[model samples]
Target: MNTSKNRRLVILMYPRVREMDVASVNDIFATANTILPENRRYQIACLSTVDAPQLDGMYGMGLRTGPLYSTFRGEIDTLIVPGGMGNELTEPPEKLLKWMRKQGSSARRVGSICTGAWLLAQAGLLDGRRATTHWNQAHLLARDFPKVTVDPDPIWVKDGNIYTSAGATSGIDLSLALLEEDHGRAVALEVARQLVVFLCRPGNQAQFSVALKEQKTENTPLADLQIWMQEHLAEDLSVPSLAQKAAMSERNFQRVFTREIGTPPSQYVERIRIEAVRRKLERSTQSMEEIASACGYGSADVMGRSFSRQLSITPGEYRSRFRSSGIMAEV
Candidate 1:
């Protein structure tokens, strides 16, 4: 509102943007301003390719721009990129990549929400750095960009100047983290509260579907089987027993299981077990030994050690940090 102030954030919308991606970024910036006074918050604007009234987003959606579109000139401090499935159309255009590269030159930082990392890589911004995209697209990104290290495990990846996130609404997590980085943990928490969303999610925490996807099965009997498998997690769940529980021979069970879920019953059980352990650690007062027993671990020490190996953090610590502070994960 004043000539002396810097309204420094520029969000780059793809020709066909993911609606939620743009919405999340704009929401965070808007909420940050409301939380901090206008004097303290960053200036936010929609910077599309042109001075236009509306832009086409993915799924034939339309997004109207603010009063004016900002240029990539040095005035902008940060550049945010959001992804869409269409980016796989081919390598990014030379002019587009060049413009992104040019924009990055003076911006304080550059980041992507989900597969927007594709655009960043096309601009040569992600070379020789670690990044992530939507988990489903991670492999394609890895195969195409041999120089960029891909870590499918993180909700968001930050390597020096570049940041990439997992699919869709995970952009909110990335945006909240940016607020935390810019202001403080308190400001970030408050911003999340206003948005009615999670303050932050540990990057390595698997998306809920990460485990479920591998366990997909076409067996019409799988609903009953999966319910049975979940019910028996605390027990010594073996393939033969699960097959028996499903009323099928082990050979039939395995075939039906693979066809339906894409993974063997034994491995799928372990994933479900891990997810249970995390929950028990978070929302319950169960001791390590108790949780271990409940999740079919023979000993508390073994369970704790397994948790460390899998999560790189002790189960107790994870609980202390992330156990339901009232923030809801958007994913």
Candidate 2:
């Protein structure tokens, strides 16, 4: 019975839960725990709405929970809720909202994912502050609670003591952000690397994955072509050039690519280029001009404008704001 709780992170799990929501939170905490100084580790627990449940995940897998309240409530540090079927977003359970309101009053910090934002909003905790949720539910949140400003962009949002994230595993991104806020960028970055997470994705980053939208089907000819395109980012990419690479007529390639990916090939290439640029911004000290050239853009202006268009910030600004604290530095 050696319950060594170096850090406390409690998540409220619900039925029909997107497995990724739970897995993402668990993965980040697990990775962060491993990196903790031997004596300093995290303790994560799952609690159900009714205190516990004999249940299954969103995709129908078995699961469990613990007590209704934390044993270390006086020392409890962070409280989180995972998104699934029910929510405090539109119509909230008076009891659930009351309990959540109580937790928000007592805990050092409060957080939620996707529809979980709905719960917080219903609890009267999110009024007059900016927050976000899954895109499918973002509009609903705004419509229900006119007082809360809903930004349907960033993968996550922080409003003073309240935190909410986009759909599903964006919870990981939110957790990583909190890790950085609690420990430091270095620890969070390490956690992300260990989990093979792309980066400590900032709250200002896009909610949806452009690369995911454009990814080709597995084992298909187009899939192989897309992989090849990703590999050769620096090469001249034109309709004729890429069509030749795909072994198709330029006109046919353009039509087929648009149909499959929902965007023109050139736009997809730009999305990949921006992803590369964003990664460089986080991990390197390269100047905007250097990043643009390395990522296949012509100049700093191109990179800066592109970032502003997609991310609402200049490349230099994004790097300064998001990368100021060196990776592995103070959280």
Candidate 3:
């Protein structure tokens, strides 16, 4: 392997920055270094604005972060800003914001984890760019910065050289993506395997889980109806059947379901069935027709269409991309 070039990755740590966000991404690059030859490895460093020997993280843990001034003139291949409670401040420290603006301007790539998007936006780095942050804080980011396009659904997003991830664990996913972009799929996959994470979740994958989305309501009847819907995904889950299960008139059930679940009954059922089909596609070697039938889609074509409409990918394509390695041989 040619080892002529190395990347300098700097993670910016601030008081109360989320420890997991910084540590997880750091471990990924550090592990990648172990996987590649010495000359091809990444030089990772953590820097903080505080002129102290140790920076205190959100959870009161001490992190070894060099003074922020040390990084202002360095060649930063990638500059990472981590999110934390500190992001909630209306007026962030002026010095830190200035450094971020300067470093972000010159860095080859600039990225953030979770609410770090706030810092990037504050620095005017995300204006006119598409970005995502922790789902809970996404609205705030958009509200605070109207010029930036906020996408709340994706696990991570990359618009040009700027990348932003959803939440804590999503930072690891973003790091894997960066590794894949810097090296190759083989190295990224190997690193993911070592980390025991699902291999390379596409940036567009939903940050929310299907199970959690389905069970969002507290109403006993609605909760039971959701469970029933999941169990009988192959059965007709139309408004009438679900309303009957809930013992409410169809009109009333539709109103309440939409209010509590945030989706129409029909749409929710379709999403559930689609989620079921996706799991089978990722884990099983069964033919598409069989898996589709088992997941209540009735036919492979129907499943494929649903996958395309909802996920923007075909069932076969999803399987190829996300299927476990153990099932790849059979595929």
CA shift of 32, model 2, Å? 3.3
On the 0 to 100 scale, the lDDT of residue 108 in model 1 is: 68
Expressed as tens digits, the lDDT of each residue in 119-238 for candidate 2 is: 788888899889999988888889989999999887888888899899986888788878877677767878877877755567776776667656755537778878777777677777
Error of 1 at 145 (Å): 3.2
Question: TM-score for every candidate vs. truth?
Answer: 0.76, 0.81, 0.78
- Model 2 TM-score on a 0 to 1 scale: 0.81
Per-residue lDDT of candidate 1, residues 1-331 (tens digit): 1223445888876567888999899898888888786667787877775467787888778988654333444466778988875785557657777777876676668999877888898888989999998888899899988999998877787787677888887888788777766776677778777877733564545554435655455555786678766777787688888887788899998887877787777777777887788766644677888899999888888877877877798888888876643222332
Which portions of model 2 miss their true places by more than 4 Å? 1-7, 34-39, 51-53, 70-75, 88-92, 216-223, 299-313, 324-331
- lDDT per residue for candidate 3 within 1-331, as digits (tens), equals 2234798898888788889998899999999999998888998877876777787888999888775654456688899888888585657778777877877778888999999898899988999999999999899888999999999998899888899999999898889878877777678778878877764566766788776866778898788878877787778788998888788999999999999999888888888888778767765689999988887776799888988999898988888876632211211
Residue runs of model 1 more than 4 Å from their true location after superposition: 1-7, 66-74, 90-99, 190-200, 207-210, 224-255, 278-287, 290-294, 305-331
Output the better candidate (1/2) by TM-score: 2
On TM-score, the stronger of 2 and 3 is: 2
Weakest ten-residue segment in model 3 by summed lDDT: 322-331
Clashing pairs in 1: 7-43, 215-261, 216-260, 216-261, 217-260, 217-261, 218-260
